[model samples]
Target: MTASIIEHQDLGTGTEEPVATAAPDLARPLIPNPQSSIPLSTTPQDHHIARMAAVALGLTLIENAIPTPLPGVKPGLANIVTLIVLTRYGWRVAAWVSLLRVLAGSLLFGSFLTPGFFLSLAGAVCSLVVLAFAQHLPTRWFGAVSHSIYAAFAHITGQMLVVYLWLIPHAGITYLIPIFATAALIFGTVNGLIAARFMNSKNEMLIHENNERHEIG
Candidate 1:
């Protein structure tokens, strides 16, 4: 392959000529062929979901750093991002973010396909199911806090079921439900407040910008 550039003869002169230069090795291929590389065909919504998922995954990493008293008990900091996505986009995008966070988080922590992964997956699915119906609730009463709380409860409930049926298979596990539920309530409310505040700030910023634009116009 050959490449050319327009070159001026003098510092002040605008007259130009094509100067040949060595081009990138097309034969070797700088970029892999689409078929060979198997790139994903994605749209704007897909990109949006991916970006949201990435943010949630970061939160997951952060949550992992925080110490927990017991196994399977997490603050679920990523769900805050999911709530934001759900209210802004809808359940589908939120579901995508939640599931992606679980999958990606497991892969990142080297726990993919493990019991922990399944537990995480079950929690995500249950939360998403609750969110699907919760989103339809009237905005007058139900908002981010309600949705988050409901989702958190659903998440813990799902995990408890998994623990009793698959992992432990003992009546003792049910006793831990209250402990998990309490944790869910506390963390869920806090997460909901944070998400609500963030969304409010974002909306106010957007409103201010729009008002300034209108003034200029």
Candidate 2:
């Protein structure tokens, strides 16, 4: 008995051959898109808000300087506005405001080219960095007193560093520590009080809260 094996293949003979599915093109990252990174100031409202904040910051600095002594020692009354802006807007905006104040204040006081300008610039830069960091700290942990102390220390540190490194290269620069520390303590206390008052004030707190909510909304 011969056994025959039958193999059958079912091939569609009437239809066109099946098209092979093409592999998908790997999706590329959308990078360097100017539309995404470029900030569009298309609205007048944005301009108005920026202008108002600028004016407020400028006026605050001038007014705060009125009561300060020794040209560099003050309660940092302008910092109140800065703190507010830091909490309200952002670090970038706060930085801009701080820079604007320094530049404008320098020009207004006619110290644009003097040592005073450099000192102020140094102090402002240090303070902004400190405040930017402080803003992220827990409010209860630092509040105003601790923030003031830190800021004062940073300010003094920046000033003294500049003086030691650039202004006075002599070894006798260390002698100024006592004087600088005293000034730091006094100004630091004053700034603490100012900051505490500003932070604790019901009206200011309410305004800040409302503004924050508005921004979020």
Candidate 3:
């Protein structure tokens, strides 16, 4: 997602400060920090992270089950979890979940440490990097949809670079760019919309729970 930099006047300082305003609906408060009573060895946060990773792995497995007409053209269903975690938890959690998904998913598929694993790893790292920067942008201008598109293109770009440098050196490989780009665009937008719906649903649930608690009190 692209962010629009807003210039804010600092009356006290008599200077303009650039404010990055995320869309009110899209931007959420950070998850509350875990309690100090929780031991460092095993914490509630770890369980939450594990759950996120498990969901992502489940999605990866489902995608793996489907047969694709074109190679490397999967819908990337696993990324939905990454998007959700990134938006709700933070980049660190999102990165950990994504890397765990790639590692565990590759192992389950019996492609651990192989070219496929590396390819997946490369794409994930690239996508995470793009997301890291994109998250800083104004949410109104760069919400989940734009973030997905950005990550999609970054993933393809990273894989293509790897293919050219290590797997296939031939210039003919460049011909595949358009096909990959087209797929990325379609899948990215679809994934973003789905994630957005999920996010909204979750947000509503949270709001309802809070209201119920307030009324009970």
Candidate 4:
């Protein structure tokens, strides 16, 4: 029967032709391939950016929940993650995380396409630009804390520009700069300290791991 089946498929050859069959695993049923099923391909970096963005988004939500005296003021706790990502990965990854957080947070909070959303986007863009320059500074002196302050100031500056140009469109808006600057300094320092501490801990853990590996070797 097998010979006859092969003979039937053998057209002009007049000889038995090999039959290709998919060997199905009895224990595992077939399903759509998770890898190729996607329309666009993704890389490890994409996933890493996504996870970091999620963390920032969570921080954003937490910051939103916290009551503040000022309307546009929050701790900016998410900046801590951005600083760390900048150091560990690079500017590109950090930018992705920061921008994604702004976009996703706005959508989540039902503020998409609103003035609030524009403010968030402006701040994020400014921070990312400042970080691009800040990253070029000497790492010895201008580390996480310095970068945090620069980015924070840039963030506020962007928001203020947006307010002056689009929203308020008056000289009176300039007066609020001092208030926003103060908030930036405070939050920047706090977030920077936290990020520095976190990075220090990670470095210590890596050193310990290397020592253990040397000992094992």
Candidate 5:
């Protein structure tokens, strides 16, 4: 009778132990809850940001489609949009948008794996990095013009570096600098003026709207 009682107790203990272990395992979450998991699809702010990025990208594509007299001379018009994004949304978001623009633009232009695509990629990356750094400066000091100038220079520099290293391995690469510099100045100034005008106009409108809202409220 004593042996039987002990055996019965052992069996009960074993079953209960398995049940307890299995219960905890079942209760565990499949994925850990992260603090950064905001549902962007439903969030109003994210929706607005997405809309802005899309619009900016559209404008960039339009600007890029415009043919220049020179082969490599682009107004860097898309860069103006990127600068605005960096100023408003921060670097990480700007970087993402810039990269997407490059990939999409490459595909759209049907130059996906060409040397030109690589050149554009290098220039775009350099521009974004320069713009990101520029955003940290006081807006009053650098403003739109300086930022555009610096970004344009960086873009040209990056393209030249890629060309010299990979694309054109000739000794005549140095001669191209004068031409790129001149072109950079012209395009950079034009884009800078456009950016400044756009930024200032937007600011004015926002202020006016805020004042009207306050009066109504």
Candidate 6:
């Protein structure tokens, strides 16, 4: 007699349903994607502008922190970066950086849309306009030092105009020009020297790198 052969699955009751297999996990991890390889979309010029703006803003904050003997007697260190950008890049690039610094600095310092911000904006705009003309002057005769002094004067003039027109209308404010001029002269010279030194060093470094590449090739 032949033994009855039956499949294991066939032994199950007809009412029993087949078990479904679990699908593979397609969900991403909850951890942050710190290792993402995507690069920033900003170009080199954008990066340069951003870096300059940041440096200028930082200088602005530092100037704000320093105690001043007078209301408008800060060192204006931020102008150094602006001068550097103007000489190295151009008036347009410098303008962008300067305006960005004013806006970002005002926002960072919690002075946005205030009288202080208006003054800063006016000063920056005037300085940029002056620099646009100044940059066209002979580089040999009008260097960073000259540009700095001119821009400093322009800045102060712009601020004074804004103050006189909007903040405080007073003819006596013109008397303060000598003091502001003195401060601008001193600070502009110092800032110009610093910017010149930095630009010189940067140029040297670039030259060295280029020489190395040439020799390598």
lDDT of 2 by residue, 98-126 (tens): 67777777777787868877886787789
TM-score of the candidate numbered 6?
0.73
The positional error of residue 208 in candidate 2, measured at the CA in angstroms, is 18
lDDT per model vs. reference:
0.82, 0.63, 0.82, 0.84, 0.71, 0.79
lDDT of 1 by residue, 69-149 (tens): 997778899999999989887788789889988999899999999999999999999999999999999999888999989
Which candidate model has the greater lDDT, 1 or 2?
A: 1
The better-scoring model by TM-score among 4 and 5 is 4
TM-score of every prediction relative to native:
0.78, 0.60, 0.75, 0.78, 0.69, 0.73
lDDT of 5 by residue, 1-217 (tens): 1222222232211122221212323455322443644322222333334445566668768877898787887777777776666666677767766777777778877988799889988998898888878878897677777877888898999999999999898879898798898888888888887878876897889999999999999
Q: Per-residue lDDT tens digits of candidate 4, residues 53-144?
A: 89999999999999999899888999999999998888988999999999999999999999999999999999999999999999888889
Choose 2 or 4, whichever is better by lDDT: 4
lDDT of the structure predicted as candidate 2: 0.63
Alpha carbon lDDT of residue 179, candidate 4? 95
Error of 4 at 183 (Å): 0.5
| Superior by TM-score: candidate 2 or candidate 5 | 5
Residue clash pairs of candidate 3: 22-139
Q: C-alpha displacement of 17 in model 6, angstroms?
A: 64
Rank by lDDT, highest first: 4, 1, 3, 6, 5, 2
In the range 136-183, model 3's lDDT, one tens digit per residue, is 989877778888889999999989988899999999998999999999
Model 6, runs deviating above 4 Å: 1-41, 202-217
Among all windows of 10 consecutive residues in model 6, the one with the lowest summed lDDT is 1-10
